[model samples]
Target: MIHRRSGSVGAGAVDGGAGWDGVEPQDYDDPSLGGVRKHELIGEAEGARQYRMRYFEVPPGGRTARERHPHDHGVMIVSGRARVTLGSETHEVGEGDVVYVAGDELHCFEALGDEPLGFVCVVGPRSAS
Candidate 1:
């Protein structure tokens, strides 16, 4: 069976590709997080037990908490640019680029340029770190 969900272009959203239908805009556990939201795209309700797919949009200059978890995650850059911090290293990424964060690896993402950094991430059910 196919569990399909559609997302529309967000109004004033950077690159117009970061909003999802029926998905609520939620914030992460970061103090410095600028105006942003995370959308859950798929999960157990959709029969995905091993992993969960989620989308996040960080406004320009926004950043995620530099934290780590026991579960690994993979992120696919879907829009805009980002300055990603992995451990003690940093890198610039854009659309179509993929990022992998191993279990317990210190990681963070900061929006670059004038656009919101949006990405779709597939991760273990524990958390999106």
Candidate 2:
């Protein structure tokens, strides 16, 4: 994964003046697998760090399989809603809500609204397995 900086302007839209540049939105290809699209924010960070943002158009009854990551992941809801199941605990996430996933924890995500659910995902450096 190539670690790409979000450019000058970020989510907070800070003003860096003259040379300030904004991060361009990149699209993820997944037309064959529903309408799931991922826009990577920060691919590879300096040293041991990684960050990414993803958008999903999950269909009704659609759900992500249980998966584990070697790094701690954090997610912030931007639009719509979702039912995130982390182990035996399930919670609803909506706009302005942030969810954190512990490293190596079993987790699953599901769309909880009639429309597609979109969110930003940020992950830390991957720990040795």
Candidate 3:
């Protein structure tokens, strides 16, 4: 087995300001999806040949697209709160909370309270596999 440690520089705004170092926020295809921005922390840019790690942030009152795919992924809330819908269950999630999304399970996140919701997401890089 190969043991690997990810190294990424730069500061990420938990509340608001700028994105992570060396990584630019991704522009969504549909702007109507709300103020959602994703920052790739560890992926091809860092020479990782497996999974990709990203940080997503949505402004207050914003939400993500409700969709599902044939891939399982994980998320860890870094800041703020949100009402998350996974499959048929909906619940409020906040900072430090961890969530697992199964393959083909529909999920969405809606920012709640006064601050933007930020979270770390990890998924297998499609190009690598």
Candidate 4:
């Protein structure tokens, strides 16, 4: 199920309060090993057609499929270690590391540590293709 919170910014209003409370927990299991979980936060801001945020937990040695998005992405590592490949650069990301990947860039991630690697993903302008 998709869930979201709405916010409004009136004219001359400096602070647009109450934007995105939180989303209910939803599991995204890998079809292969069935050990990983991904909790998604689908963005719903009034008129925006496409916006999403996801919390991913990649199990040890687990990897994601090579993919591309129609819009930009902001990824922040929360815990453990992750090997992120954005385009041609592959780097190790840990806690507090943030990566920005532009639109249509081929990217993938793999859990490099013994524990589960967690990260927050923000994607804009969902693709129709």
Candidate 5:
């Protein structure tokens, strides 16, 4: 089954290309992830109660921080090519490639092509307690 969200932003918007109106690309909070920017597509502001969707862009020769989290992640490559490291295994991914990161698994994404590597990721809300 296909799931879709509609509103002022997200997949419902009529904007062309990978970007949406009102969404601004921001630098990755972690400095270790070089030349990475993030655009939040869906989250608490969108009234989503379960998950948040985000788009990440890594410039050529850049990579995401190598870290592990307790929350699982669903990632899909939307543009360019990347070298994704899941645990100890690293694999090359291109457009339309899907990646599943299990809870507490070590993972990172590196842009391998001249253009920016863009990908969308869905993640569950973090527990407050």
Candidate 6:
């Protein structure tokens, strides 16, 4: 389950380090899976009622776990290159490229360049259960 924190001040000016002030980067790996660090840009604490924005960095030779969720995702490459697997197809993506992963579609991302693969992902709100 995901946890929500209160008191976020929203975005910062500098995009260097692929991070912003007030936001902390955390491991995106699950005990059952591994690879990737993530920073939450906007969420419930930031007054977002419908969506959340996050940034992910996958180091070279690293990859996110192959998994599927019931939510859709809007992903945009921010830096470096990556190979994104969506469903049965895999494609190369670079900075400025955008990808859409529909709900329940299996997907994963692997860093392909010497540098880390950085990307922004926007996800729809989760139901309160």
Best by TM-score: 1
Question: Rank order by lDDT, top first?
Answer: 1, 5, 6, 3, 4, 2
Per-model TM-score on C-alpha atoms: 0.83, 0.62, 0.82, 0.69, 0.81, 0.81
Task: In candidate 5, list every pair of residues with a backbone clash.
Answer: none
C-alpha lDDT of all candidate models, in order = 0.78, 0.56, 0.75, 0.66, 0.76, 0.76
Q: Which candidate do you rate higher for lDDT, 2 or 5?
A: 5
Error of 5 at 41 (Å): 0.3
- What's every prediction's RMSD, in angstroms? 3.0, 7.8, 5.0, 10.1, 5.8, 6.5
What is candidate 6's TM-score against the reference? 0.81
Pairs with steric clashes in candidate 4: none
TM value for model 2: 0.62
* Tens digits of lDDT, candidate 2, 24-70: 33333434445344544454432334444443334434455567777
| lDDT of residue 92 for candidate 4 | 89
Model 5 lDDT per residue over 23-99, tens place:
66677989767567777888776778798889887777889888888889999987778999999999999989999
Model 3 TM? 0.82
- lDDT for model 5, on a 0 to 1 scale? 0.76
| Stretches > 4 Å off in candidate 6 | 1-17, 31-35
Candidate 6 lDDT over 49-78, as tens digits, reads 899899887767778888899999999987
Q: How close is candidate 4 to the true structure, as a TM-score?
A: 0.69
Per-residue alpha-carbon lDDT of candidate 4 for residues 1-129, written as tens digits (9 for 90 to 100): 434445421211112221234544443544764445555565554345667777666667877767776789899987668889999999988878999988889898788856667677888766732
